[model samples]
Target: MNQYQRTHETMAAYERLHLAAAEERGGETLAAAWASVVRQWRVVLAAAGVGLVVALVFLAVTPPQYSARALVLIDPKNDFSVRATRAPTDSNTDSANIESQVEILRSDRIVRKVIEAENLVDHPAFRPGVLSQVLSTLKFWDRETPAKTELARMEATTRALQKQVTAKRLGLTYVVELTATMPDPVEAARVVNAYAHAYMDGQLQFREELASRTSKALQERTEELKKQAQNAERAVEELKFSGSLQGENSASARVALKNLESTAQTYRVIHDKFLERYAETLQQQYFTVPDAQIVSAGFPPLNKSYPKTLIVLATALFLSAALGSLLALLLDRRFGGARLKRDHFA
Candidate 1:
């Protein structure tokens, strides 16, 4: 055979051989992918098993939290808010001033008061036994740090408790919800009730403050009016007694007398009217706490709200299995040379 023909035939044979080898490699790649998945099956199972175990342990060790809630109807009549001062309604009720009250309910001042009411700092949950309480009680010993340091520490504990308690607004209604959570059911109930009581007391205090301020302002105004009236009366009397009327022209004298008399009369009328209005305003100033009835009380929760065992365990198991499957697929891909570079030099 000619050299060129032989060379052409050899090239064709090499091309056919290459194609067959490539086909064989592709088949092996698929088999290896399956093998990788099989190899990693044990790992996937182990991960899932470990995840399940951890979830079970968490469920066993963690203690459950108890919750209690109370509902309060905001009184619109008692709610004389600064916003409504420009155009006040005929009657104020609990419902009218709830927005301000809601802010108060969640305030630190209320939280601190509630903590004080329960004496929560000395409780077992806070300090863990009588010894902890005794150390807390030794106030004078820690003179360098200040007694407030201990109080601050106690405050931290109370702050944590406060965070757990919440006051929420009812749906388009004039009701406020006060809720607290504690290990003991009774403590939760007491704390919630105290919050309601404190809110009512605060309302009464607000009214008293308004009344006292208005009274003081009115009294000062009344005194000023009285002084002005006296001055006017003195001027009239002086003009008459001095006999300036006789010395001046007859028409001028008459005019002066009439002017003084008119000035005195105006002042007298103004003083009388102010006195009457001030008296009426004073009579209307009175602060009273509204009677709040509890709509619901918090009770001991029968079940714990945390450490969802079944759900956690199931999630962990699922993720572990999925990871194992992915690892298997990656190994199979590598063996199949899914990523390869052609060699031009060869």
Candidate 2:
């Protein structure tokens, strides 16, 4: 036989040896196991009682957490956006667009903005959460950086905040929900509200930046157009003053004057159009609005959302029963009230 086969057979022999010992003490049948458990019911109850006491102690020590949620509606087809962008949306594009907005809500940019605006780095809820504390207690991390440099502390705080915050879309709808869970219900609600406001603020800031860039570009273009118009007008004026009618070159001079006049008129018209657009851009800045709006504000939760009493108690009871049953079965096999005959094995 191969080495693997031999190893498997050896393990199989060991299991059979243990099973034979079990059968030697009592029969290896479901009814036999159930009878053994029934016989040792007192021990099982005592073990379960002890487990209940321990569970009570654990529940007393566990901290409570509360979650608060806020809702935001994303309208991608806002008035400030380009006409082409506001066109009828395709299903694939709309779905992708909503998904992208969800990611933006989770993005570091939006998170950091909220963090800074709400001063979350200095907030009481800014520590690594319960799971991280448990892992740290188990020595899963070598060096903790939250207590290190200022930048490191900020980064650590950001990570902690990110963990506490959850951003997701509700079904396929355009409404996005942002949730924050904290030991303090008020703080949790505040954080969720801050996130919603920050997202809308970010959109407003983006539009302002876009408008600023456009204004600067238009100003530059308007100046260039004005310069061209001036040059064309200057050329036409020079041609008129050059005595075109008295010269043998009057025919050619008139033609050149006509062309220059045409050029000046064209430049003036283009420059006027740009001036009008620049004025419109400035006006639109005043009427600018965010594409996203807070549909529902977060409120402090009335009850703690974590370390539920019934769940903890039920879980402890279930585990205790299972463990007690296993122990009782083993004890019965060790020293049974009734033993089975092993004449067949012999």
Candidate 3:
């Protein structure tokens, strides 16, 4: 080999050696860091154990709540695009209300109907508990009549029910999700179903009332028009007969006869129109359309909706360990090294 080639080979060997030493040094640093992490595991474990105990206590003490859901379809049928608009939203009828279907479901009127039908006012679930009794006594120390007390109880129960029950339209769909949360899952299901049924009943009742009122009004108007038409026809016949008796074939007589005939014709046309409308009202009343229907009825939930135990415990443990590691690091900075281990034992 030439002098220059030998020198280059020697330099390359020294570079390889330098790279090897650097890699070994980096590996040692990584091992030391891992060991340090392993040493702090005791802190993490201690914190995690404390967190687990706290979670366990919370699970034991906290009362579980049950939730039941019911799906009510706002427009169950294709009635909206059809004559249902006239049946329900009939502006001509004053008895029918123009309230939105979803709003009607959530209204206090419908809710109160359910409460009354189910006799919730007398139920212990609706009645005031110990806390409520204490507050009521504190506020109203004076004696109150049983009647007044009953009224107050009813009002309180309604307000409480309003809070427990919720109705919301699901996105752009016609479905409305009605949910009720109560201590008793069965009661929750019953109440939710009750509310749905109440809303539907109200809609049916409203349609009936509207149809009845409209039909009655139309009948009255039609009878009056019929009488007027008959009277007009009778007058025209009398006029023609009187003209025939007098044998008056003059231009004025013909003109008078023509006017009488026109009046009778006008009355007859109006009577026919009213008669048609009355028939339609009767038909609509018989085949009344419902504003909403219970698409999916609520049932008692199998699992408690509140206080998810497993998730809570896992989250608690993870957070505690993370915080513990941070605290360990701080101690390593504060009292650092062998002293931190000594302090941990102490």
Which one wins on TM-score?
3
Question: Which stretches of model 2 miss by more than 4 angstroms?
Answer: 1-29, 79-89, 128-148, 230-269, 341-346
What is the C-alpha lDDT profile of model 3 across 61-149, one tens digit per residue?
98777889999876544342235334544332322222356677777898789889888886766666789788888976678899988
TM accuracy, model 3: 0.73
In the range 30-146, model 2's lDDT, one tens digit per residue, is 778788789999878978898898889988998788999999998776647343235787777877888998998898898888888888785766776689668657974556565
lDDT of 1 by residue, 265-300 (tens): 887887787687666556546533443445776565
Q: Against the unseen true structure, what C-alpha lDDT does each candidate score?
A: 0.69, 0.84, 0.80
User: TM-scores, in order shown?
Assistant: 0.60, 0.72, 0.73
What TM-score quantifies how close candidate 2 is to the native fold? 0.72
Question: Which one wins by TM-score: 1 or 2?
Answer: 2
Return the number of clashes found in candidate 3. 0
Residue 198, candidate 2: alpha-carbon lDDT: 87
TM-score of 1: 0.60
What total of clashing residue pairs does each candidate reach? Answer: 13, 0, 0
